[model samples]
Target: MSMINYKYSFTILLAGFFLISCNGKKTENTRENNAENQITISEGQFKENGMELGKPVVKPFTEEVSCKGYITAPVNARAKVTSLISGKITSLQIRPGQFVSKGNVICAITSTEFIDIQKDYAENSAKFVKIKADYDRLKSLREENIGAEKDFISIKSDYNAASASLNAARAKLNSIGLNPANIENGKIYNVYTVTAPISGYVTSISAVLGQYADMTTEIAEIVNVNQTQLTLSVFENDVYRLKPGQIVRFNVAGSTENLLAKLISIGKSINTESKTIDCIANMETSLNKPLINEGYVQANIITAQTELQALPNSAFVKSEGAFFVYILKEKKSGNYIFEKKEVHITKSNDEYSAVSESLPEQETLIKGGSTL
Candidate 1:
């Protein structure tokens, strides 16, 4: 009784295990199939959910070349405030992040050279006056045949030389922001004022109080925010595909919002260090926001436009490394039957994508609802 009963019980237990394993495999396969199968949504719910459908329309999409660079001001829009003369910085009227206008005094410096310039101008002015008087008298006498011709010529030469020296000294004073008219025989301009050359916000300050500065010393750097451009570096491989008037979309570092610009020029030479060509783009619009100078940005230069069959960005969803678009298969009773069809994306942009395979002519495609 023991051996026969035990054999029967073991066979029944083995049959039950096999039955449970087959059902579990079937359920798992069904779940996987459901993801790519037909989806049915009620018409009322679809409308409430703001789903839209239309035929695959032919729209323009651009093939883009990815790039990276910085936002920079144009050449004329940027200015370097420098010390035109050598002096120790006595005062600083402006600092970094300060806005200044053209001709505004940026700083005051005390320079012994300014005193020397003034002294030379004063001495030259006095000499010019005396020389001119002598030359005039000699010329008058020569016209009346009362002075020697050699004497008249010698005085004329002296007069011309004196005048030139005076003018040069005056120009030197003017270049250093001292008016010749404001100087007298002994009056000296101890403090020279440096003025801003352009209107812009100061980006950097290199000179501080008590610091010595010269013609090579840059006191500050200014950039006009209203006049800015994008300086992008595109690899030489993609350089030939670029041209003026192409659209450029960029995202500044630390931002995901898209900004737009237009390509204005391409650098003729490639960078030896990077093997990339410099591309200049003018900011077409900023939506009331101004671009910061030297802001790093990642950009896509839209190169070519082609009209192709495509759908809205929301209409396609990526799953398991493939893109699928929802197609309206049929409307039965009150249900909208949509099928998820894998699509071959030939080209794509931020707003649309072009599919290689043409969908059915009469069937409509969902343009908005992909998440459902």
Candidate 2:
């Protein structure tokens, strides 16, 4: 009876051990099924989560170089108004920011030298008339064989000398802004008018109403906004990529609007102090108002174009100094799994980025992977 009890107890223990082993196997299988690193979702769940898939595409990529610069008027567009003759500023007609047209009188000056020039012109004119009349009379006598050859020659020489003096005096009056015909009409005035050389806004005024102005003094400055240029300083490394007619996009400092410009010229040599070359560009569009000369600006020059394999910027996920994306894999009907992938990005813009590690073009990519 004891031996029978021992056999029954041994059987019970064996059965219990087998059951426990089966249970452990089931638990291990369950954990293996759920331990995948990939994420699996049904079609309905994907739509609910607002997930999307796309394929990599080939698109045109533009390479750009960044630069800093300022707005400046071209040399021909800027004028330094100066007096051609020394005089006292009797009347000042221009102030800073005033618009003036070409040939408009900017100031009036009075000087004793101006009066003396006019008087000399008038006296020379009278002397020339008398000498010419005497010359003509002597020539008539010589032709009729009634006057000596020596006398006629002497009179002709005097006439030529008088004519030269009169011409020189007239030119001097003209140089002082006096019309020679008006001066010859006996309109002698002490004040000489100084006119604007170009149509533009006056930027500076240095002549006072009662101050004396010399020929070398800068009376005022005029700048034509229409001829303004964008002067950019490009580093030596990127200067070789720039060329005339390239498109440029720039923004003024302290403004949000982007402006357009076209490259016009590039400097021949790099500056020794700044180690940069000058790039000149013209504005393609008119501003609402004239830009102040020497206003600071930031610019990007579109240098070259090529085709590249690009993806939307939303596809990138960055972590721990590495970038990643999600690629989709079909598991079964109505279900999909996404596997994380490592990629190297070459370049990026606001909307798209060019990546180096290329996948099959047919492979599906999960959009908005960074949010996962």
* Model 2 global lDDT (CA atoms, 0 to 1): 0.86
- The deviation in Å at residue 214 for candidate 1 is 1.9
Models 1 onward score TM values of: 0.79, 0.74
In candidate 2, what are the lDDT values of residues 283-369, reduced to their tens digit? 997788887778899999999888888778887889899888777766588887877777899878777788888765655555646
Q: Model 1 residue 48 lDDT?
A: 84
Per residue, candidate 1 scores C-alpha lDDT tens digits across 191-223 of: 888899999999998888999888889888998
Q: Residue 6 in candidate 2 has what lDDT?
A: 95
Candidate 2 collision pairs: none
Scanning candidate 2 in windows of ten residues, the lowest lDDT window is 362-371
Quote the lDDT for 64 in model 2: 95
Using alpha carbons, what is the TM-score of model 2?
0.74
